[model samples]
Target: MAVNQTQSSLVIPDNNASVSGNPGPWTEPTFTLAAKVRVGVTCCFFLIASCSNVAVLCSISGKRCKSHLRVLILSLSVADLLVTFLVMPLDSLWNVMVQWYAGELSCKVLNFGKLFAMYSAALVLVVISLDRHWAILYPLSFTSAGQRNRIMLWTAWITSLLLASPQLFLFRLRTAPGVNFTQCATHGSFTQHWQETAYNMFTFCTLFVTPLVVMIVCYTRILWEIGKQMKHKNELARSKNDLISKARLKTLKMTLVIVASFMVCWTPYYLLGLWYWFQPEMINQTPEYLNHSLFLFGLLHTCTDPLVYGLYTPSFKEDLRSWIRRISSILSRRAKNSKQLAISELNIKDLTSMEGPTSTAVTMQSVF
Candidate 1:
């Protein structure tokens, strides 16, 4: 969440440009060092998020009966895919182009997509935290966990779409008065300065604050529950439910890690956005590369979620190993086949050369 939610967050509001007698041309976006850095870093994140999230989906997808945990993780993976496929690519392309070239329709659609992707990821994490909270506090009450989780996941996705739908209306192609530069932003859409600020703040609350509070509360209670469980460890050690209790605790720890990564990765970027909202002048004071870096840093959360998931998932690791071995086996067979073919070709060449010499000698003798 940047000062401007859409338009690549590159178009900082300038109140005086139209007020001036001679409005200068908008300085075009260049593929400078800042952009180069964004491209490189975002590409790395894209690959990581894409591969890791897809792997998570695949590893859990084949299970006949998914627990609420798996369902929430699957939903999270899908949300990460949205960020990986939509936000990362769009940001890279928009930065490289430096302006809106994909026309007004594309501008609206892509802006909507960016917001939707972000909202989905944040909301899914909220769902995951809430699910864990419910499971920990009321294990017996989770009679239909799958059905309940499905409903929550649906609600999260629909809410994400609804929250992000305004971007289509709020953003459009805004061209400079005398310049050919057009940006996908909310410049003309908002009549007053405060309206844009209100919108940004609203987005900030939805994208960061609300979700943060929910997760913090959920995880805090979970920690308290863990502490209580530790107090009864000796009793649980003698009970038949000991193994089940330990497994649940391990899963809770893993989910907390995923939540922690999301918070750690995005906290700084959103905090910067909050500061910029209060002090609009920071946009100018801040170096270009710093802005780019901060946004890319926030994107790191998308990659980290999958890494956390994969780390906790033993089945995913086993599947990965199997995949690696299968690929290596296929490569080795191809290499061996190629070597054999080369040897056979060499033998054919030798036979052809020897036949040529023998035929030449026979012709010479006939001529004599």
Candidate 2:
């Protein structure tokens, strides 16, 4: 999710604030070349994330039985799709416009939508990690996995909604004095600076810190369970245990890679946000380009999720390949048809030209 740190660069400094004087004649952000590049990059990531996640949805939906794995994949894809459709385009458009043109109502709703999508993306992965932990550690749990998965899905979505709801109350259209630039931010939401910082700290904890800890803990337990099983196996089962250990380790390694990438992508932005919330002066101290770069780097996580998950998932990878071939064939046929149609038009024009000459020759012969 985007933080106020991003808007700090765009926001005009308050004369009443305790920061450096005037930062001199505040200049509002414009549709600069950097903004244009951001829009283009965001668009590219949006398209990639949209297609991959949609493919994941379609592939899972087409299956005859909805296993827990498929269900988890569907949930992850849905979460990514939410980010692809909601966050990427909105952020890009906001950058291009350099201000919130939509009304205050739209601002509140979009802000809510953004945070909701962000929560869903992170929380669903937490759900998946928990599911994996349960399946591996307690294979014969009291509750059926299907039932448990449904419950977790409901909880993830409901929790995301509840957490993001505050955005509706916190964000509004704020216009600078004597300027037409109005932006959607939490500028006037809190009376005290500490209150605003407190709210941001709460969001940061819920959105990033808690989910991350849950996922890492879940996987850590899973890996321990795996190693324990290997250690306790009988000598007679050593050969089979080796195979199982190798396979499990390979899968878990990939899972850890996903967690690592998630951290790498989001950690910088969140850390920067944490710093800015405490040290408001750093808002001016941080470069605008650095903020943009980190925000986009965070957005890259949305694009990476599907690719990583799909590439490793045999079924999803096959579905993606089949889809690529299908799209390629369709385009090929359309292009071939267009070429043929053009040839026919050229031939018709040539015949029409010849018709005039032939008519003139016939007329001259008749005259003779």
Candidate 3:
């Protein structure tokens, strides 16, 4: 029998290209160009907004502002910033330009970073929603702080790392058959097909669907509590305006914004992915439109995270204002001090002149 080189386990064919030994079906170039432009712009927006949020959060000091929620917000902001700065930009560049300029190592790093940030963000949002729900529903029972919250945060980090590990193994950069450019994708082989399927299912369910359900339930209960509180006609204005009640209202509003932003940012991507999962044939038939649409939807998450930060975090705004005010005060004080020194020097010179010959001779001798 002839040597069966094609049947070897070490060799794998790129399924992304056409069967005629060509690179691709070569869909409309316009779609790819538009998708690239959109992703690039969105990534830039994400980077700017997330970096601003991180700066704002870092400026906050003192004890009153350092709650569990604040800490969680900071973590989320860091995660968002990482995704914006590290993952989305690279991914956008690759997809939009239709080339992976980065090497294999970068592809792996991007895959890991993207999955890590995404899962961490999703988990934190769920935790925030639950924290708000508990604070609203059972205020006395959920007094976690300091060590407890730290422990929980550590746990979240570990969980996120574990959840995102699979992506590192599953994704790789590979040259498409007969093509010069490499693309990032799951390793497609007979042995890895089932693994990819399982990975996709797990990622979709845990990172998107499950947390989304939990958020919906938690927010619904929170809204119900707020409505109940609002309807109490006999409730004293003093109690309504109490610090705890006001804080609760603020928490509710923040939670609403978080959930809304999460849904708005991720829903399109989830829907697009679901369509692809259920109908893989669409990839070959309408690769340009479907892929571009999916890419655009995915970019939305990176862009909307900063909006969530701005809407939800009052302390972020306060800290920004405080920094501006502090700088202004410092500048003002320095200017005043300089003016006072100038006035004092002028007065001293006038006094020296008034003291006549003795002081004038002494001043002239010191100057010489």
Candidate 4:
């Protein structure tokens, strides 16, 4: 029940950098008045996001469930974790420095990884939504572990990579006339205008719009099925079937919340990106601060997913708490040992000082 999927549309292609082909003497207002503070805040959120998602992965690893839902949950957690590790730090650095210091290949790889993570997260959630739809509607015919389900998971990754492949080719280092430093930009040509537009449209539809529609439809069907099942609930006693019904309802609600969170977090960024796609001049008119704000909002989804997991999944909470306690215990023991070591050394020094030159034998056991 460790359901998690947070896809950010902010890391799409960074067209803002690309759009500035011919530079002028323009002042880019750093998003927040205190740019350092904003950078610190973003970095803190990314760190929290990284830690929480890694904890989710640890929790998942501690369990052994062969259910297809479990597999999907693992996939989603891994995708989100990758976003935290691979994308968030670079995002923070870019926000603060406002330049691509890591060079061309890194820029391409960074963009590719970000897009890959976003697409994979979206695809996994869509598949999970569909899986739940089938499970609820065709209970008798449904099984979590199937060869088809494995194929579907594989296809999801393959398709995400294919969709994200453009990032690897399109993004590279570029320089504007006035800028001294290079920036990571998607190179756009006059002939590739339609191609760029088409690709952006495809990414938006496939990663955000289509997934939202599918999840909404699937959850709608799931709700209808749950309502129908409830009508027959009185005929059966409080048994396994009843428990399953309750569990299904709980899961449906959890998934709805997760989906809602994803929508709220990414919609602004994606919508703004789409607007930028068609009306490139609008970018020049838009406040520099607003773009960063939208990107930060979308970035928040990475941290929010782990919180959603803790709220919805009791088992995940327990496992995560257990892992935290284990880490705390290890730290505690190390601290204690260090303390004892210091005390023992001090006692030995005290004994040597007290008992004069030949006092090598000290009661270290007593000190301990």
TM per candidate: 0.90, 0.86, 0.73, 0.84
lDDT of 1 at 179: 70
Q: 1-368, model 3: which lDDT tens digit per residue? A: 00011011111322322322345344222224556556766666666666675664574434445467667677767766766675566555554555556777776677677777777777877777777777788877556644555676677778889987766666667564554645565535226434444556777888888989999999898888878877994774776447777877776786677678778866766766665554444444554545445545555664565565656666666777887899999999999999997886786688687997688767656645
Task: Give the alpha carbon lDDT tens digit for every residue of 1-368 in model 4.
Answer: 00010111122233434444533344432434544555676788877988888877777675554466667777878878777777677666665666567878887887888888888888887877877777678777555445556777899999989988878787777664554655676644324566767777877888899999999899888888777767987776888987886777677677677777888988887888788777655665866566667767777887887788778888887887787799999999999999998887887888878887655543545554
**If both were scored by lDDT, which would come out higher, candidate 1 or candidate 4?**
1
> What lDDT does model 2 reach?
0.77
Better-scoring candidate (TM-score), 1 or 3: 1
lDDT of 2 by residue, 231-271 (tens): 87674255865675465455456556666678899999898
- List per-prediction Cα lDDT, in the order shown: 0.79, 0.77, 0.62, 0.70
What local lDDT score does residue 149 receive in model 2, on the 0 to 100 scale? 88
Among these predictions, the greatest TM-score belongs to: 1
Enumerate residue pairs that collide in model 4.
Answer: none
- Clash tally for model 1: 0
Best of the candidates, lDDT: 1
lDDT of 1 by residue, 1-368 (tens): 36354233456444323433334444555567878888999999998889888888988886733477778888889999999999989988887887778899998898888889889999998988888898888887678778888899999999999999998898787776667777887767866656767888999999889999999999999889878988977656556566666677777888899888888888888888887766665666777777777787788888887777778778888888988899999999999999997886676567658788766556446535
Candidate 1 clashes between residue pairs 3 or more apart in a chain or in different chains: none
* Rank ordering of all candidates by TM-score, starting from the highest: 1, 2, 4, 3
How should the candidates be ordered by lDDT, best one leading? Answer: 1, 2, 4, 3
Model 4 residue runs over 4 Å out of place are 1-38, 64-66, 144-146, 189-192, 231-238, 361-368
Off by over 4 Å in 3: 1-31, 61-66, 145-148, 189-195, 231-237, 284-315, 322-368
RMSD of 1: 4.9
